[model samples]
Structure formats: structure tokens, C-alpha cells
Target chain A: AQSVAQPEDQVNVAEGNPLTVKCTYSVSGNPYLFWYVQYPNRGLQFLLKYITGDNLVKGSYGFEAEFNKSQTSFHLKKPSALVSDSALYFCAVENGNKLVFGAGTILRVKS
Target chain B: EAGVVQSPRYKIIEKKQPVAFWCNPISGHNTLYWYLQNLGQGPELLIRYENEEAVDDSQLPKDRFSAERLKGVDSTLKIQPAELGDSAVYLCASSFGSGAYNEQFFGPGTRLTVL
Candidate 1:
């Protein structure tokens, strides 16, 4: 079955340090990967997407993700973490008409 | 363009009571989706609509959950005789099309609490 996996349940990082949220996927065809962030009491906000071309995709809130074909991973990254960037992040892979999302990873950036 | 709109940011009800959540997709968007999100989990697609036709609903619990996208615009998701397990955030999202390239925009969602 097609699925997305966020290996980490929660990742804690210092505010000024670089952070990485790992994600891997198992899909049939070419993968269409995406990242979304959800804040407390709010709906998910689109972060970035990897449809075709360009392994490095940048998105809102200074976030970027590197899409690796051989590794089957699309890991979210930020050069410098901010306290405000702490939230629940989800990795999703498009499966035909539906999107299969990972369980989600809680990112906590402590100042 | 205005983002997808959902009504009743929060709702509380007894387990056996019925509840409905409304969603208005972004103007001109031909596809709408309803998702169920549990605490500490990602949103799961409950149903998907292409225009007024339900293209996919395999994940929806037909015994208690039903959804309609009449007129190919606004949508309504209803749960009759709700159960405690049904307590969750009902999220509405829309995109111009259902293709992989189309990014979905989400609404604030309706948080339902079953007592």
C-alpha cells in the first residue's frame, strides 16, 4: 500500500540551530511529495511540494525540503529554527486521487 | 482568492446526537475534499468530490457518515447517531483540480467533541 512515514514522533531543536524532520515514502509511480504544518487550534498550512524537477523545494516560512529519489525521502529542513516554527508537521504522498499522510511529527524549538 | 471556508469552529454534543459541518470551497475550484483529523495525527481523507460527483468515498464510514457536494460548490458532511470515536476535527480543503500538481488549500476546520 502507498504510504508516507515520518520516522520521528517529536523532534526537539534549539532555536538557533538547524533542524531536520525526516520523512520517507513508499508509492507505486513517481511520487508527488508535500509538506504541511499545523499550528495549535488551526488548520494545516501548506509548506512545500515536490512534483517534478528540482530536488530542493522551498516554501512558506523559510522552510525547504530535499527530495531524494533513491532514498525515497523528502525531508523538511530549515537553516535556523525559530520558536514560532514549532508545530506539527506532516509529510504526504499523492496516491492517485487521494493523499496519504504520515502520522505526523511534532517539532519543538526551544529558545 | 478567498480560502476554503468552514463553519462552526467548535461543536460539543452527546454521543448519540447528530452533527453537520459545512464547507465552501474556493471559488472556481472544481474539486473538494473532506478529511478527519484526530488529535496528534494527520488528516485522513474521508471523501473526495469532483464537481457534484463523489469520485472517492471509500474511507468514509457509510453507516454513520455521509457527504454531499450539491451544485458543485459548497459541501456538507453529516454524521447521524454519532459515537464517541467520531470526535475529531473535520477539515475541508479544495484545489483547482484533482491532479497531483494542484496544491490543496485547507479551512480552519470544525472541531467536534462528543461527550
Candidate 2:
């Protein structure tokens, strides 16, 4: 079955340090990958998506994700982490008509 | 443009009680979706509607859960005889033009707690 996996349950980073949240996907066809962030008690917010573009996709809140076709991974990254960036990050891949999401990874940026 | 709108930011009810949540998708968005989000997990799609038609509802528990988008606009999801395991966040999202591939706008979900 088509699925996405977020290997990390939580990622800790010092403020101003680079942060990475790992994600891997398995699907039948070329995938449409996306990243979303959810704050406490809030709905998921769209970050970025990789459809058919350059491998590097930029998104909201100063976040970006690299889509590696050979590796079947779309990992979210930020050049410099911020305390405010701490939240639940989700990776998703579009199946036929729905999005299959990973378990999620908590990104905690400490000051 | 206004984002997708949902009512009842939070709801708590005893088991066996019936509860309903409402959603109003962004204007001109014909694709609507309802998802169930368990604690510490990503939201899972329960049902999806293409205008007034229910295209994909295989994941929805038809015995106790039902949803409708009557005029192809606002929608409602009803759960009868709620159970403790049913407690979670119900999220509503909508995308313009098509489904899955387009950008989907989400609303603040209704947090449900079954006691």
C-alpha cells in the first residue's frame, strides 16, 4: 500500500542551528509529496509540495523540503531553527484522491 | 478570500451520545474532505466529496458516521452513539478545481472528546 514514514518521533535542535526532519514514501507512481505543520490545537498548515519541479521545493514559514526520487524521500529542512518553529510536522503523499500521511515528527527547537 | 470554516472548536460528550460537526469550505472550492486525527498522529481521510457527490467514503464507518454536502457548499458530519475510541479531532479541508493534487485549505478542527 502507498504510505509515508517519518522515521523520527522527535527532532531537537538548538535555535539558529540547521534542522532536518526525515521522511520517506512508498507509492506506485511518481509521487506528489507535501509537508505540513500543526500547532497546538490548530489545523495542519501547508508547507510545501513536490509535484513536477526542481528537486528543492520552498514553502511557508521559511521551510523547504528536498525531494529525492532515487531515495524515495522528501525531507523537510530549515537553514536556521527558531523556537517558534517547534511543532508537529507531517509528511504526506497524494494517493489516487486522498493524501496518505506519515505518523508525524515533533520538531522542538530549543533556545 | 476566507479560509475553510468549521464550527464547534471543541465538544465533549458522554459515550452513546450523538454529535455533529459542521464545515464551510472556501468559496468556489468543489472538493471537500473530512479527516479524523487521533492524538499524536496525522489526520486520516474519512470521507471526500466532489460537489454533492460522495466519491470516496470507503474509510468512513457507515454504521455510525454519515456526512453530507447538500448544495455542494457547506457540509455536516454526524456521529451517532459515540465511543471513547471515537474521540479525536475532526478536520475539514477544501481544494479548488480538483482533488488531491490541488492546494487544500484547512479549517480549525472541532476537537471531540467522548467521555
> Which numbered prediction scores highest in DockQ against the true structure?
2
TM-score to native of every candidate shown: 0.97, 0.98
Candidate with maximal TM-score: 2
Interface C-alpha root-mean-square deviation of candidate 2: 1.0
The regions of model 2 sitting more than 4 angstroms off are none
lDDT of 1 by residue, B1-115 (tens): 6888999999999999999999999999999999999987889999999999999999999999999988999999999989999999999999898775688889999999999
List ranges where model 1 is wrong by over 4 Å. none
Error of 1 at A78 (Å): 0.7
Candidate 2 C-alpha lDDT tens digits along B21-88:
99999999999999999988889999999999989999999999999999999999999989999999
How far off is residue B55 in model 1, in Å? 0.4
lDDT at A36, model 1: 94
List, for all models, the DockQ compared with the true complex.
0.75, 0.79
TM-score of predicted model 1?
A: 0.97
